[model samples]
Target: MIISLSPRATLLETIPFPAVTVCNMNGAKKSVAEDIDQNQSNDSDSLFEKHMLRKLCRDNELMSGSKVNASWSKMQNFMVKVSQPCHTMLVACLWRSEEMPCHAMFNPEITDEGMCCSFNKVKRNFIYRNPRQLHGLNYTFPYPSIDWTPESGYPPDAPANANPWRVFGPGKGLGLTIVLDAELFDYYCSSTASVGFKVLLHSPVETPRVSEFAYFITPGDEARVEITPKISTTTPDLVNIPESKRRCVFTSERNLRFYRTYTQRNCELECQSNFTLQECKCVPFYLPKDSSTRICGTADDECVENVKDITEKRLPEDYKNRTGWEKPRNINCSCLPSCVQIFYTKQMSTGKLEDMFNVQKSFLGGKNLSYYKQNMAVVHFFFVENYFTSFEKGEIFGFTDFLSSTGGLLGLFLGFSFMSAAEIAYFVTIKVLFSKLRKNQRKENITQTRIFKSLPFAE
Candidate 1:
């Protein structure tokens, strides 16, 4: 039997395999005409070679570069667990007319900003995804599958789920009104140097960093954020162009190994993780890294801090002049921005909660309204209007336009068009032959007239 390999195989792959295929020669050999099939699993040497080959392929991951993928896993194995529970952070929650329990409303996620309670950011498969699988599942955030994207909004026939799902505009009853109980007494060191909750609206695909971007909602004051959903997308026509040439990657074009959905923030985070790994030899606990990628411990704290400072600090060289004689961030990251992006821009309005306390008391089950007014912050999240301006990136001169225009002529033949080619053909062949035929006909007529005139004397 002849075994053929693919022509596209590299020079290294052209080598003959020393390992032999294991095939049964008993019953199959009895029939001389029958073909024998070999099982690859039975070949111990072949199996070992394949396994080693796979490991060798992944060996390059040890090196550092931009656009490198960072693994993102659950924070269950980390030493830090349950620093601050969701119930403690969010005392009360209200979305539209429905009231959600503090524990069930938000899903817990670990970030650089410490304990985070994510709202409407969990996987649709599970209501509350328990970090430890042995503990079993909990239906804390009992909602339908979120089928919304930057390219496509919520389905027209989607289930009536919650505030974000419903798409309600600016109104007290229609939006998400949450009363935050900022337990400032237990505060040790405030990162923002203020006593209040940091309110942030970001893509559900992204990990929210409090230090990166946030809007502070001070305690005892009601802050209403008039959300204006911003969307930026590249035209579908640009999909044919190479990602490297376009300088932007579509969701399907560049997929992150850790993230299910690709976003600009996700790309940057992944890039940062790889850069950190390159400089410090280990990545931060918060960054998305696989088990193989070493987690930065106490020993690597200094290195990690230095890397963070380099990335976070605003430097003219970072943005203004990329090319320099010697740069600290030489190979920072070759990450291209995502073709599509969605951001929630908020316009906040603040006022003392003492004035809006009487009506909110009933929502709190008639508890100590006077006490909550002093310690609580009611935040409302709603759309400012039904319509908002969104940006779209498209090709100015498309392929079809080029083919129809003078550009196509230059591509087909140097400095010549279809009209010019047609004119040349007419003059060189058709025009020359037609003129010769007319001249020959005229000569034949003249010859016939002269012959007739000479023969008239005989008639």
Candidate 2:
């Protein structure tokens, strides 16, 4: 009799098996089948080799299919959990608003002081004797002539240039330009107080960027400048957590009116200045000073403390209502943090240098001996991350992503596509709705027939 066998059955039957034998060595019996199984098990130790063996064995009972399938399943899971990587670039700068104190000295010949130049001699004495008193004062060399127009032209915006730098003995050394007076440079070198400057950062990309400048200095002689950068990030949703949570993301003005890139520190300083002006009708010497307002001196320490307490809301309830004391509007000064994280650190060093140069010839035709000494401070900025820009790897998956992955797997292994998904939806929704409608129609027809049959007269 002839018999037909299925493909799986044929495959199983075709799988080869080694012959078994019994042998004795040193009074110990060993089976040849056991030796063959041991060699096969050793060959199957590697996952790839095991998988190949299982495929080769087909439906053979000698291979465990579950183990090979599980290995591939684990690999697929690992690939699905991987994250994507990206990179970015950035640019930034530093700036300040408060004006530096400077003085211009006249040539002895022009002032007609002979051996003793009034402008140079007196100003030098005043600077060395009482530097604090010279904070907002402007001194012209030999005074300005009737026809003399201010060499430093007005800045385009006045509010930004409200407290313009005092350029001493200058030719167009005003506004943001450095003072050209040698004497003023000497004074800056000798001054014990640290100076402050504004820093601004600019970038072409749409990503948000911010920076902050911090330094250690004497507490009472602290520099007035405050550096704060805006917060920005590509992953806003992740960094900007709700009030109940937090994330790692952190979140400039022009010449006079700094560009909007000004940092939070800038806003706070400006707000404090405004508050001081409103309370004491003056600002501290370190802050911007105008003709309408005098600089706050040591004598105004009490008033300054009062204003600080009120503005910062540190005063008691009774003192809160003190006349002319109003809380500063911090809301208007609100600043946001950048989504991207940025940290900037600075190191500074100081040194002294000596040089000799010929001073301008005086009317006396004799050159006076002048000593040039300079004390300089250098600052270096570096990124803590050791890179100008950085990248973060993240994974964002949702229910839609899961469904898409499932559909992709189906298409890869079972030939399923969008059309197949649409057909399934149609069967579950449209077909089911139609079937329900037909069932209701049949029940209504049955009731109608029964009602008609019961109406004997109308039959």
Candidate 3:
């Protein structure tokens, strides 16, 4: 035992430690090291998560679908189809009701004297009741207004000063379908000895789509208005997309003068109203009429006729040397449709009805059909399949745009990042203020020491 022991051996022999306990202690140390490694990995993962969240937020700000850029080159495609019955049927029967008084019948007692009576006579009876004596019948029903609904009845809830017979249907179906009944047509023919009807086939789209139609009939006799639908497809050079999404940048304000919002229909309507005002000294009741301006009435028929004549007869040569504001030699009011084009091809047939039958048992009964024997025509109108087609234009910025913008900003301002911005804020709000406060305190202390020295007193 007297053998020389090294310092390590002597230290181990002095401690009352077992080998198994030392092994267990070493295992505990390994476990602690493993926990430290896991913590480091978790910290790296958290940093990665933070970076991803920041990138996502930035991407959402730039690529959110709320805003769009204006561009002229952008384009969108639309396919519209309208399905309708091949043989369209329009039953021209009198819409009659007791509520609607007959102004055509004259009082026998009042007219017996053979004296001149006032033109504005009292309507004492209903027109349908005295069908035999329907000479002075006025078949001109008032046009329906924009808000007019058939559910509200014949006389709509309208303003007193508003025009009557301003009949306007809401809107047509995108792909419209219509069915024709031969039995209904036959019933209309037998129900009235004579009737008046006009069949019009036009695009369901509002104004600026196309004002003209193929089939037009004047009030009188039983007739058939047939349309062999033809399509005139137009792919406009320019297109309109939603303003909320994108808009045209190159178009001038003067070019879009008619519409404040720049829609084809609005522009056309505005142009028409302006033309009417210039020619007739009044706007049509159907068009927008200012309160100061009078609406065109029956009295203004002559002016309307004159305007129509001027529009139809003037030649292009006559327009030479005239200013743009000056009325064109031809009363040409050109309002081009936007990108959408709708064309209707029409054909017609006509015939006469010999006898009359009871219309109360027909489909036209509940609709309040009024009869006028002088005008008789069963007009049918409908659209064919694939009736409408539209094209739109729009613009957008993609992820590449966002990356390019970000890179540009970064290149333009080197060393500028969120950390740099935070540092700047800290400098301005905390570091600068602390420096100023220390400087002021130093100055104040110096001043106090000088005052003490100047007083020549020590406490």
Error of 1 at 139 (Å): 8.6
Where does model 2 exceed 4 Å of error? 1-261, 275-282, 288-303, 306-332, 337-344, 347-428, 457-459
Residue runs of model 1 more than 4 Å from their true location after superposition: 1-82, 124-140, 146-157, 162-170, 291-293, 310-332, 355-359, 362-370, 402-421, 424-459
Model 3: per-residue Cα lDDT over 253-340, one tens digit each: 2244222232344455556566667866775433433445554533454555455444434444543443333454435544444322
- In angstroms, give how far residue 454 of model 2 lies from its true place: 1.5
Error of 3 at 7 (Å): 99
lDDT of 2 by residue, 1-459 (tens): 111211211111111111001000001002321232345454333443334223222323534433332232232222122100000000011112223222232211100000111111222222222333322223343432221111112244423212221221211121121111122221211111342222222221111111122123221121222112122233333433342233222311122122122334433445556767776666753343333456553345557768666544545454547667554444243433333322222333333322243322221112123222221111222111111223331325545667888899999999999999899999999999999999999999999999988975843
lDDT of 2: 0.31
**On TM-score, who's better, 2 or 3?**
2
lDDT of 3 at 363: 30
Distance from true position, residue 127, model 2, in Å? 28
